[model samples]
Target: MIVGEQKPIAEIKEMVAPYKKLLVLGCGTCVKTCFAGGEDETAVLASAIRLVSRKEGRTIEVEELTVERQCENEFIQEAAEAVGRNDSVLSLACGAGVQAIARRFVTKPVLPGVNTTFIGVLEKQGLFTEECSGCGNCELALFGAVCPVTRCAKKLLNGPCGGSQAGKCEVNPDTDCAWQMIIERLKILGQLDNLRAYVPPKNWNTSTSGGPRKLVREDHII
Candidate 1:
């Protein structure tokens, strides 16, 4: 899932200070799981803004709403009436969600309330760790499902660089060496010979170097 963190309240205050009628829009999917911009978060933020405005002797009407998702048009459209009634929208979703809302409501100012972090998974309660870089091409089958591209500090294809020590990464002692983990996993799976064949240089063109990507499925298209 896409992981993100909520922006500072101070910064958020400054952004919405100019607007009298503000809408705090939340996403109930990814951001909800991370506790960044879910329904509860949206309400708390709205109340905070109102309290701040009251303390400042100013009146700011804040409304809270949470959609199933902000990235998809169908979910975003559900908030159309609420959005149209607000002076501006404070999006507490991922960067993609914020941009999607902005694109749909071209005339309204869409302010981001969260900083999109990375593609990752929940390691434990309240702890999310990045696991993928979305390089377009997936090479997990070659490395026993451990992605060296994301785990390796050097992004080495055939690694366990010379600096690795005690099964820990050279870049950060706290991090496990990607190659070490890969080798162990391969050994356990009886696929150690897979590393014997040298991997050629990766074709980065398939990645972001090609710019914004799109998937087209003729069979799925209606």
Candidate 2:
């Protein structure tokens, strides 16, 4: 999931201070799982902003609401209507969701309430680790389902980059070498031949194309 971290309360307040009526928008998906832009965090931020405004002798009106998803147009449209009634909106969703809300509601100014971190997975309870960089190219088949692009520090295609020592990455001794892990995994599965095949470098231009990328679904065509 796309992971994110909340900005400071002071920063959030500063961004929307000019607008007396501000809506604190929360997303109940990725942000919720990461504990950054969830309902509880939104409420706390709203309440804190209210307190700060009051202490500063400024009457700031802040309201909190969590949408099922901010990335969806339907949800964004509903939130847009709610935001239309307010002066501004502080979106507590990921960068994508924040942009979606902004696109759907071009009239109202949307301020981000969190810093979008990365594509990651929950390592354990209350711990999240970055796993993917969304590099556009996928090579899991060549690497035993392990992503060398993201896991390998050097992002080497056919690597264990000479620096790797004792199954650990040279960049960070604490970290395991992604290629090493892949080789070991392939060996265990008797698929060591998979590593013999060379995978080409990723075409980043197509991946990070300027502006939004679109996909068409013939079955879902309206």
lDDT of 1: 0.94
lDDT of 2: 0.87
lDDT for position 127 in model 1: 90
- Per-residue lDDT of 1-222 in model 2, one digit per residue for the tens? 999999988788778889989999999999999999999999998999999999999998888899989999877766766798798889999999999988888888999999998899998998887788776667677788878888999888888789988999988888889988999889988999877777776677645653456668999998
Cα displacement (angstroms), candidate 1, residue 4, comes to: 0.7
- Candidate 1 lDDT over residue span 69-164, tens digit each: 999999999999999999899999999999999999999999999999989999999999878999989999999999999999999998879999
Candidate 2 clashing pairs, residues 3+ apart or interchain:
none
Task: Give per-residue lDDT, candidate 2, residue 167.
Answer: 93
Per-candidate TM equals: 0.95, 0.90
